[model samples]
Target: MVMTQGWIKDNVQEGTPIKVARIYMKNATLAGDDLFIDNLFIGSDYDNYIRTSLPATPNGNFVYDVEVSKIDLGFDINFMAANCGHDFPLLGIKDATVLSGSAEPYSDIVVYGHPDFTAGTNMAVGRIVAATKPVTGSFELELNGKLVTVAADATAKKMKELVETNLDTGIVLVNQYGTCAGYAWDVEWASKGGNQPLIKVWCVV
Candidate 1:
């Protein structure tokens, strides 16, 4: 037998290379049984809250583009806005879309007599993905793999553009192999030769 003592831990620590989440564990969100609150005066992504007016008919969830015309009520949400931010694109990924109900407003409206179990009359957005496709690009020396992430729900083409933009920006991200080494991708115009520019390769069984 052994004696036990109290201990503590934290999810994040500095200088330890906090790995960005890749394989997310499943959560209650999988059931899509999201929480709901109604009758609020107003909301916006500025404060991590999004505002929306109840449409004539609740269109359900997973909708990326919606035109909210009832702006007279002071609801500043424009789902159809270029990337949808009520005009605040500056927020980028921190905007309303980050929230679960960003697309499915009035999901479970009790005031409307709608039960709280149905997330929306639709499906949740799926991660844009590719299978068995060659990742085209010359890598720096041996760097090959890339962990790309897109905050908003968009087409596969759009996703590629965003990922490329992220790489071109030269933002230092902690890759699986290195830190701040930047994109090892080689370019015919200008780029340093890498170790075959292939960071990683895998065989699907």
Candidate 2:
């Protein structure tokens, strides 16, 4: 028999409005009644006896403390960020169109999503799929094996200028849409694109 202890830190703060929508395991396997779980308790305290102090052994069961926090709200969290505090480096800029292309020369530009709410969900791994400048001054991205392109516009130009001017340092994130638009992508520079320099955005599918 194998016995183990587990603990999970929930993000529902002291005053965050929430509800236990449902309780169900995503996956499970049972054979000959091999696995049995009982005395499962989920609450702020142990047995309502200690309100502030968490008991090391709740109901005679050894407990394990697990560190977990929400990296960002309204986005599908991966295993790392959901269980640990590790967060992926996400590139965020305003009024920018993220695109996708291959590393080869003159690759076909793949455009996905519009500047505002047209592309779709933004809860995936983003990476630099391509760096070649497809247009005058736009960025490209590869998301989920599909090429997504953000055309060079005011936003792209601004981001490029910022990145260039800041000695290639990290840029601040600006969420104008009130939530993550699911444009998980990387950053790159295309010296010859559009009216000015271009910032390429690509997703790592």
Candidate 3:
């Protein structure tokens, strides 16, 4: 279990947006049951403000206040939970190509998207897979019909020159990784008796 609290200082004006500076939790356990957060008070001054019961979702009530006016304001978040059978997963993990570079005038790149599900449907899912290959040789830069010498570790400068000298010039990064793709599924059905909806969702690696 972890208990934490912190404060945030921000500048704003009346009638402006007021961003939430912080959210404090008295007790947070990874292996806890479904938790509910309530009694949230957010505003610039104690006299005039708004209050409500927050949603009981992971990372849901973390941000409570924002710039309501063009003035600086502050608020406090209070919540509690119990130990049960609920756990959160870790995010931000990528083992594939992570490309980042300057965009060219007309170049094509691959993009991906996730699936959308219907409300009260019980389940929703999506998947994406990619593969790459490698090559080794003396890479060269050409201007007009002649090969030009480009300094090592000057990929950016060389690329800019290529684009300027030849409006149709381009740069490409090549590598080899195995093929990767998978399928996902989500299904939900109302349970018999008085039980809630039974839901199942999964993805293949």
| Alpha-carbon lDDT, every model | 0.29, 0.36, 0.30
Worst 10-residue lDDT window, candidate 1: 82-91
lDDT of 2 by residue, 1-205 (tens): 1223332235445566567767554214311112334345765555523357654432232333433345565333222121112222333334544455322223333233444663564322243232222123445533233344444332434444445454333343322111111122234434524442344355333
List ranges where model 1 is wrong by over 4 Å. 1-78, 84-107, 110-195, 200-205
lDDT (C-alpha) at residue 44 in model 3: 51
The 10-residue segment of model 2 with minimum total lDDT is: 174-183
* Clash tally, candidates in order: 11, 24, 28
lDDT of 3 by residue, 146-193 (tens): 454333223333435543444323332222222111111221222223
lDDT of 1 by residue, 1-205 (tens): 1212212125434345544444232233312122333333322222333448653222232223544344453233334321111211111221223334332221321111123325543223221211121122322111234544432223234434544454442322221211121112222312334433323323222
**TM-score, per-candidate, Cα-based:** 0.16, 0.16, 0.15
Q: State, as a TM-score between 0 and 1, how close model 3 is to the true structure.
A: 0.15
Top-down lDDT ranking: 2, 3, 1
